[model samples]
Structures are given as structure tokens and as C-alpha cells.
Target: MNGLFGENLKYDLKASLVVFLVALPLCLGIAVASGAPPMAGLIAGIVGGIVAGSISGSHVAVSGPAAGLTVIVLDSISSLGGFQLFLGAVVAAGLIQLILGLVKAGVLGYYFPHSVIKGMLTAIGLILILKQIPHALGYDKDHIGDMAFEQMDQHNTFTEIYYAFIYNSPGAIPIVLIGLLILFLFEKPKIKTHKLFGIIPGPLWAVIAGILINETYRFWIPGWQLGGDHLVSIPELTSLGDITSLLTFPDFSLIADPNFWLVAFTVAIIASIETLLSVEAGDKLDPYKRITPASRELVAQGTGNMLSGFIGGLPLTVVIVRTTANVSSGARTKMSAIFHGFLLLILVLAIPGLLNKIPLSCLAAVLFLVGYKLANPAIFIKEYKKGFDQFLPFILTVIAILLTDLLVGIGIGMVVGLFFVIKTNFHRSLVVTELNGNYLVKLQKDVSFLNKAPLMKQLSTIPPGSNVVLNAVKARFIDHDIKELLDDFIETAPNKDIEIILEGFSNHVRQKA
Candidate 1:
């Protein structure tokens, strides 16, 4: 056990660092989007990294405030009358999550269809692509949390694109172009083969290059600017004393408001779903094929959120973006997760000023690449080869997610997949056999209520004055509803002048003659 855990610890450190780098700007951006102090996001990241990572059973999963929850936090704060009150709701949500974890409610995660999950990743990818456009072009009017195109306007994603192009700030163009070029060059397969180049990820390189270009341009041009508004900025903290003062307590007074409960419930449900999905996906990506403990993950998340709420932070979950980064970075253990959290804490305490210099456009470039990889065309080709049963639902899920929001799209795709499953099972069982002018009805094994329609149709077609034999030798368990339907059919068969004989029974019972 020591050797196994030791190996994992080494891998976790490397993976955690990669996740930390990816998470830094995201944490700040999401916090800014929530209309709370920028430090709130950082606090959540720190807590999620340290508190959550330490306890979570998910070895490769990384926890932090998610962009999907920004809108929820914003609404909660507004309705609750203040950010502190919203923190109270978050604490309540955390308690709920803890209860859920203790009760082993995480099993509900299994019911989510695979197609829907794929679709969610694809939809989130598409949203990242859309949301990043303005940042890529250097437009910083909205925070990173603005996901829906409709929220920008009344129309769809295309309309938002048209407006951004017509009204975007030109200064952002140069920085965006440079960032994109850096991303493109780093992704070249030839570069990845080189020993030196392979050591650093494309996102890290793009960010470094972006920082250099911005600093150089500022030095030479004097009055020229690269649109500082399009960059991430850390909240100004002059001293350790100031940082201490920034922490806010949850306002228990808000517990009296019904809206607080509503928001807490919403946060708990969504966070659980997102965390479970991330756990499943992260486990699939693990090289060791290790299964993560889902209920334990909830407890970890709950603990982190509770701490975050008490200390002026947003709710968090096991985010897919950071979890994927952890896996790709060769992370093997929970130690890496814990180390990353410590890193966040150290960075925030030591260098808030330095972190503020990173450009939002550069981060957008990283997310763009991440999004593309998740919804790559290669995945479609791979799924297609698996046959229509797999690809059809997957494609529908992708399309639905892109057209609508995550949950709605997944729900629609699941319904479609379930329909196909039922239809196929029913069609495969309706076979006919003729023996001396009598019909032999052979039902498939494991027939259930889903097969009732086809079974009834077959029973109705039995010829008058012909003997009908019901076969059950090959059958396993039949649903009680189906058994009752067959019994009803036996009673009604004599009225149709058919002599029904039951096979595989002690007595050869016939329909009343």
C-alpha cells in the first residue's frame, strides 16, 4: 500500500501543478463574474484545492468554483440582499451536499446517459468557443461567466457574433492575433515530439509569450495600449493585514428568507451533477483505470464549500477542465490535488500584483484549445464506427446541447435513446412460426412491459379454430405486468375460436373450450 500510494503521490504533484496553472485565471474571472470581490473566487480555489483535495476520494479530480455556477451565485446574492447573506445559503447548500454524500445518494449519477454526458461536454465546448470570441478580440465588456448568447441579446449565438464583429475594440485585435499564433505554433505536432518543447504545455507557452509581447509593446509604444481591460486583474491587497480583513462571514440572518433555501437547493443539485460527471470522466481518463469513490467526493466537496462560505467564497465542484488537465499532466495521486491547493494559497498570499498582469485573451486561447479537444471531429468518427445505436444518440445529444442549455439538451437526448432501446427490443421479438395450421408464438427472453404492444399484436393475429401454443422454455424472468397481460390474452382467446395450449407447464391448460 505504501508503494502504491507513493507512486501516486509523485504523479499527483506534477498533475496538480498543471491544474493549478490552468485554474488561476479561471478562479479570478469567475469570481469577478459573480459580482463579488475578486478575492472570493481565489478563496474558493484555495479552499477547494486544499480542503476539498485533502478529503476527496477522487484521485485525479480538482475542485474549484465553476463558471456554470456564476449565474446562480449572482442571483442568490441579489435576492438575498448582500453577498454575505448569499454565503449563508452556500453554507446551507454545503450541509445538504454532506447529507447527500453520507446517504450514498451519489449513485444517482449512474442514471445519466453516456450520450447526454458527451453532449454536455460538446455543448460546454461550443459555449467556450463562443464566450472566448470577445476576449480573443479583446472585448472585455462582460465577465467570463456570461455563457448564453441570448443573455447578450434576444437572438441566438450567431446574432451575438454579428454584433461583436461590428462593435468590437480594434486594440484587442493585435493581442488576440499574437495569442492565437502562439497557441497555433505550440500545437504543431512536430513541436510536441521535441524533448524540450514537450516539457511545457501550449497554454503555458502562450501565456508567457502573451505577457512578454504585452510588456514589450508597452515599453516601446509609450502611449500605445493592448487593452488592459481585456486582462485578468487580482484584487489589490496591500498587506497580510488587508487580506485578513477581506474574509467575510456567512450571514445567518438570511436563513429566514425562502429564496435562500431555493438557491441553496439549486446549487446543491447542480454541483452534485457536475461533480459526478467530472468524476466519471476523470476516472475514464486515468491510466490505471482506478474507480473514484463518488459519495466520498461529495463529502469532500461539501467540506470545501462550507469552508469557502464561512470565508467569503463561492460554491465549488470537481471541475472537468482542471480534472482533465490533471490527467493529461500525468497526475497519479491525491497528493497532486493537495499540492495544487497549497500552491494557490501561496500564490494568492505572495503575488497578487503579478497575477493581475496576465491577459484574459491569452486565457481565452487556452480554453479555446481545451474546448476544441473535447468536441473534436475525431470523436465523431470514432463513435460512428461503433454503429447507429451509439452514434445516433451521441449526435443528437451534441446537437441538442449546442442548440439549448446543458441539462435540457441531455434530457432530450436521453429520451430519444430510451425510445430506440425500447423499439429495438420490441421489434426483435415479433417472430412467427406455423405448424400444421396452428401458430407458435415465441417470446424473447426477459420480456417486460415495454414489449406489451408487440406481444398483444401477435396474440390478436392467431387464426380462428387453430391451436396456438405459447412457448416459455427459453424465457427467463417475465415482468408481472406482462404475465398478467398473457393471462388476459388466454381468457380472451376462446372468444376468438382459438385453442390456446400452454407449454412448459405441468398441465396442458387450454383456453375455455
Candidate 2:
């Protein structure tokens, strides 16, 4: 343990605290969104940090209860008849994921185009900024981790922002603004080098400052104070007994139920997809540019969910928001993720009251910066310069995700990307070059029916007196359609006074009447 983490311990410790702060509210919010006990979210967060972090190959990704699974879990719990039955489904789902990893199904991530992946990241960035605007203004109707365009609160992303503008909280505005300033100040070179400020990251100070300001409001400016829903709202635990009571084990009797298996299969497929996508996003954001084994990540996530269900917890996945927070915080190793789990455990046990004082607006400011870093205008410009083949898919992905959800948006982008791939291949299959009334039509490799129209067009344009050479030596296979086109062109050559020469095609092309 010392050898792996000793060199990066200091960096990881700071990063861990930042991730813990980011994960805390998200965990609770996702639990509420999933219609499960708040303690379940915390348990999943803890296990993801400790068990998944320990078992996974990723250096900076932090796993926890994912927003993507909220709708599935909420509906599944009711369909399965109870939360205990749902817990059984979660355990079974984990086992299915384990089997998928062993079968190397993780390679599905590799088939996605890079442009689509970038689009997914950029979309999440935009979503973070758009979603947090309401929270920053103290509109707490929607949970913090909800990523879908449409919210369960009957407000879409834009509508929520519109409503926030009208009913903004006065106290939260200043706290968020002040928090942003503090975070910006801490990022300055001189402040970062400060003996004390540099050691502890800026987010901790921002949370602390928010607490002090809110407390001051309570005493002197009661009208502008934030409490209840505006605060962190961690489940209070006064004794060790309170902690044990929250734990709920899975009902093993559900193992024989078909409904249980249906829910388990759905959870396993979705969780694996989310994990694969999140890992792709995480690897892109890592400063070290390290690649993680996708199959191993599946195994790690499976292990975490199994353990979480064995006790009481929500389903777990490699969450993009928390993973982004960890990478943006300069996490150096997996210890940061593991330590963040321990911090969550400690928060629930010893300091729920203290953490509860943190204003949600303050955390909003932190995410705002993370969002800006991701969706910077420069990224758009860079992708646009790559041409329509890349830019089209990238922009489409961002729009699709913004309008729909992550998986659907990515699927749309992939279809567009595949279209471009076929279009490019169609054009490049056969090369046509002309010199001084003579033409060399070279087929480089396989020429399929998709390229037949272009090949015919090129062959038809040869002048009446021109000499044409059809080169097929390099082509390993020519579709029957292409061979027929060549035969027709050859038979008509004498009438136009066009000379036809075929190289390495005597066996394939026959003269036709």
C-alpha cells in the first residue's frame, strides 16, 4: 500500500477531500431520485470508493450511485414488489456483470467513435452548467445529480433555469458568488503557493466560508438565510445503533422469481454500459493519459455492487460527475478515491451535523468551474477544424445528449459516424487519375457495390480518342457489379475509338456483346 500510494499520498489526500464533497450531495440526491433510503446512497458511495477503487485499474475514476440508473431502479423496485426484492436484483445484476467481464464484453466501448466520446464529455459539461444554475440560485426542486434533459419535477433543463431567474434566493446568490471568488483566488499562483492555502484545496475553504456566511445570516439577516432543503441534508445519526438500523440485506428468496431476473438483467446491462462510458470519459480527462482495462473495471464494479446489495445500497456505476471532479482536482492515484469513501463513512458516522451546514450553492460554484473547463469554446473550435467527418458527429452528439439522454445521444452520434465512414470508404476504394488524354483507374483494395456508381461515372467520362488503363492488380476482390461495369465499358471501346487495357484483370472481367 505504501509503495503504491506513498509518493502521491499528499496529492491524493487533497483530491480525495474534493471528491468527497462533490460525491456527498450527489449520493443522497440519486438515492432520493431512485426512491430508496438516503443511507443506501451513502453505502454505495462508500463501497464504490473502497471496494471498486481498490479492485479497479483506473487511477482517478470515482464510482457511486449513478443518476442514469435512477429511473430504472425506481421502476424496478415497484415492479419487484419491494426494496428487499430490488436488493436481490442488484446482487444478481452484479453477478451478471461479473460474467460479462469474464467474457470480455467490455470491448463494446472501443467501437464508439472518438468524436462521439468527445461529444458525450462536452454534453455532460453543458449539462453540469445548465443543471447547476438552478441549484446555484437555490432552486432545490430537482436533485443535484439528475442529468437527463427532462426532470421529474415537470421542468425541463431550460424551464428550470427560466424559473430560477424569477424566484432566485438572495442568500444563495452571494454565497455562490463568494464561493466562486474564493475558488478562483485559491487557483492563483501566489495563493496556491501559500503555506496554508496551498496545502488544503480551495473547495474546502469555499465550503467553510459558506457555512460561516449562512450562520451569520441566521443571526443578523434572518430573512436571507438558507436551511432545510438548501443545506446538505445528510441523514442524522446520533449513535452507532442508528447506523446498524439503516442496513437492509437482500432477500435471497427472490432468487427463484422471474421478475427478479428481469430486473437483474436490465440493471446489469445498463450498469455495464454506464461504467464503460464513464471509464472512456475518465481516461480522456486524466492528465497522465493512462488507459484503464475495461474488463477489469466491469469486474470491479460487479464486486462493489455485490457487496453493496449484500448490506444495503443503491446500484453503483463509474459516475462521470464524480470522476470529473476527481480528475479536475488533480488526483494522482486510486488512494484518492478510496480515501474519499472513508471520508463519506466518517461524514455519516461522526460529522453529519457539521457537513449539513454546507450550502448547496457553494458546491454549485465548484461544479461550474469544472463544467467550464470541459465545455470550453476552444474545444468546439478544435473539433470544427477537424472537418465535417469529425465535427458533424461531435456537434450532433452534444445536441442529441442535450435534447435526450446519454445513451440515446451516443447511439445517434454513432450512426452518423458510421455513415461518414461508409461515405469515405466509397470514395477512396477506387483511384482515378488522368494525364494527357490517358487515364489510370487504379483499384487499391476491395471494391464493393457501394463504389460502383462512382466507378461508372469515372469510366464514362473518358474522351472518344483517349487510351484508358484499368488497374486491378492491387484489388483482392471486386464485387460482381463492378466487373459487369468494366465488361460493358470494354465492349464499347472500339466504337468510341477509346483503347482499353486491363492489368491483372484477365480472369475476372470478360468481353461482353
Candidate 3:
């Protein structure tokens, strides 16, 4: 017990506080964005920090409700007919993820194309900005977390922005503008390095500033006061009984629904991919250079999601944003994660009224910044510079998700990425170049049956009376079809008056031929 709490306690304690502040607004905002009760996000944050932190092999990785999953969660709840039914999907997903971890299937994350994943994130960013614009302008007809282009209120993404201008609230404008200023100020490097500012996150300050400004308007300028739907509303817990009553359980009866299983499988796969990617990024940032066992991480995330779902929380996954903050704050162990969870639990249980005073516009502004970061123009330029092989899938993913839904968009991106891989493979494996009267045919990679046609075509194009060099030194494996093609070419070389120079296929070719 002493050793557990003695060594590195100071550093971990300070880091935990910083991470908790950073996570607080994000948890609430993500819940509001996901159309779940604000407390649900808090529950996931606590479970991720305490349960996942305890079980995961990672020393500093932090888990929570992610912005990436908000779209799926919102869509699933509506399609499943109720939040209770959606919780069942979360539970099932946790079970599937647990089974995957036990069977050592964590390596599946590597199969996903990098371009597709980036595109998915970029799409989510765009959705966040579009959906949050209404809330930021005080047009609260739709749920704060709605991300679909079409709204339940009969307005589309762009039309909603037009409506926002027509019905803009006088009070929300100042609150959001001031909130953004605070957040942006806190993000500045000089202020971020300040001891007080560094310890307290920008979003928290934005929330505080929003609360004070609204209260001030309420007293001084009643005409510009914001209230009701414009403010965050959380179910306050006053006693132990209230706490139990506030916690909800999933509907196990939904297990027979095919849609439930589909949602489950989708959540499991995406959560696992996000978890593996976040943990890998954490390992890269670790000063200790400690490697997190990917399989163990999946198990930890699965356990957290199960508990979170049972208690009516959003699905859980390791979040890179919080994890980066944890590491940068000098966290040395998982104890910091556990401590941050306790802090979140304390905040919701002890002072939900304080959380309720925060304006939705403040949260919207925070999300606006997040969206800009994810869909930054610089990201597009970077991908474009990487060539069309990467940019095509990336842009297609963003377009597909914006046009359709998350799952279908990802599917489209994956198919496009695979097509590029096959097309590039056929064109890039063998190279035929001519210099003066000599021809050099180089094997850039392994020669399989896929390369037979290209190899034959290149060999056929060589002019008569030219010297040809067949270079297979770079190829590790040569298929029988390729070898046959080479032998046939050599047999006909004499007829074409071409001299063949064999560079790397002594064993594969016949001496007589």
C-alpha cells in the first residue's frame, strides 16, 4: 500500500488533476453531442479512467467517450428506437471485443488503411462543426449532439446555418464569443506554460467564463439573459438513493435484434481500432519507451465498455487527446488515470448544479475549435502532397461520410484504398527502361502471377538486336509463371537477334535454355 501511494505520488497527483480538468468539458460536450444525458458521458469517463486504467498494460494512456463515436451513438439510439436498446448494443460490442482480445486478434487494427482512418476522423470533424453551429448561434431546436446532415426539425446542415442567423439569440452570441476568446487565450504557448493556466484546462475556463457572463447578464441586462434550453441541464444527485436511481441498465431483451448485432459489431471494430491506434501513439510519446501489449489493451477497453454500458454510459475507448495531456502533464503511472476518474465521479455527484450553469454555446465553441483542428486545411495539404494514392481515399471518405453515414463512408474508403493497392501493384512491381541499344528490366518486388502479364508485355516491347538485362536481384520470390515467361523470352531472344544477360535468376533458369 505504501509503495503504491508513496513513490511518484506528487507527480501523479498533479498530472491527474490536470487530466481531470482537460477531460471534464470534453466528457460533458461529447454526451450533449451524442444526444445522451450529460451524466452518461461522465460515467464513461470515470469507468475509462478507473476500470480501464487498472486493467490496461499502459502506464499513461487515458480512456473515455470519444468525439469520433458521437455520430454512431446518436444514429444507433434513434434507429434502435431508444437509448436503452442502444445500450444493449454497447454491451454486446464489449463482449465481442473481449473475445477478440482473448483470441489475440488485436493485430486486426493494422489491416485498416491509414488514409481511410484519417478520412473518417476528418469527416467526423466536419460533422461536429456543422451540427454545433446551430447551438453556438442559440438555435436549440435540434439536439446538441445531432451530426447528420438532415435534421429531425426539417432543416439540413446549410439551411440550419441560415436559420441560426434568422433566430440568433442576443445573449448566446457574447457568451460564445467570450468563451472562445478564453479558450484560445489559454491555448497560447506562453499562457499554457503558466503554472495556474497549465494546471487548469482551457475548456474548464471557458465554461467558468460562460457561467459568470450569463449570471452577470441575468442580473444587469435581463433582456440578454440566456436560460432553459440554452444552458446545460444535468440530473442532480443528492443522495445514495438518487445515485442508484440515476444509473440506468441496458435492455438485454434487444439481444435478438439483428440491428443490435450490427451496431454491436460496428462499435466493437471501430472502438478496437481507435484503442489500438491511441495506445500505439501513447507508446511513442512515453519517456520510458514502454510498449503497451495491444491484446491486453483491448481486454481493458472491453471491460470498461461493459461496465459503462451496464451503467448507461457511452462506449469507451482510449482517447488520444486526454492521453497526450496526461503524458505532457508528467503522469508517471496508471494511478493518475484512476485518480482522474475519482475526480469526475466527485464532480457529478457533489456539484451537478455548477455543471448545469455552463452555457451550451460555450461547449459549442469548444467543439468548434476541436472540429477545426481535426479538419484543418493543413491536413488536406499534407495528404495531397503525399500523392493521389493517399489523397483519393482520404477525400472520398470525407465526401462519402458527409453524404451518407459513418459506416457506409468507411466502407467506401476501404474499397477505394484496396483498388489503389492492386492498381499500383501491377504498375510498380516491374520496371522496363531503355538506354541507347540496351534494355534493363528490373524486378522491384516479389514476382507473382499478377506480374506475369506486365513482365511479358515489357519483354515483348524490347527492340531486336538490343542487349537486355533481366534483373531479379531485388525480388525475393519468383512465381513459376514469371519464370516461364522469362525462359520463353530467352529462348526467342536468338530469333530476335537480342543478347540476354541474366543477373539474378541462375537457379530458376535452365542452363541449356
Which digits, one per residue and each the tens of the lDDT, describe model 2 over residues 108-222? 8777788998998899889989999998999888888787898887779999999988988889999999999999998798997899789989998999999999999988899
The model with the greatest lDDT is 2
Q: Cα RMSDs of all predictions?
A: 3.4, 2.6, 4.4
TM-score, candidate 2, is: 0.93
Candidate 2 differs from the real structure by a C-alpha RMSD in angstroms, to one decimal, of 2.6
User: What is the number of backbone collisions in each predicted candidate, taken in the order shown?
Assistant: 1, 0, 1
Tens digits of per-residue lDDT for model 3, 348-375: 6888788778778888877777667667
For residues 465-488, what per-residue lDDT tens digits would candidate 1 score against the true structure? 888888766566566777777788
List the candidate 3 regions with Cα displacement exceeding 4 Å: 1-39, 57-62, 66-89, 111-126, 195-199, 250-266, 277-292, 319-340, 398-424, 506-512
Estimate the TM-score of every prediction: 0.88, 0.93, 0.81
How would the candidate models be sorted by TM-score, starting from the highest? 2, 1, 3
Question: Worst 10-residue stretch by lDDT in candidate 2?
Answer: 1-10
Least well predicted 10-residue stretch by lDDT in candidate 3: 143-152
Using TM-score as the measure, the top candidate is 2
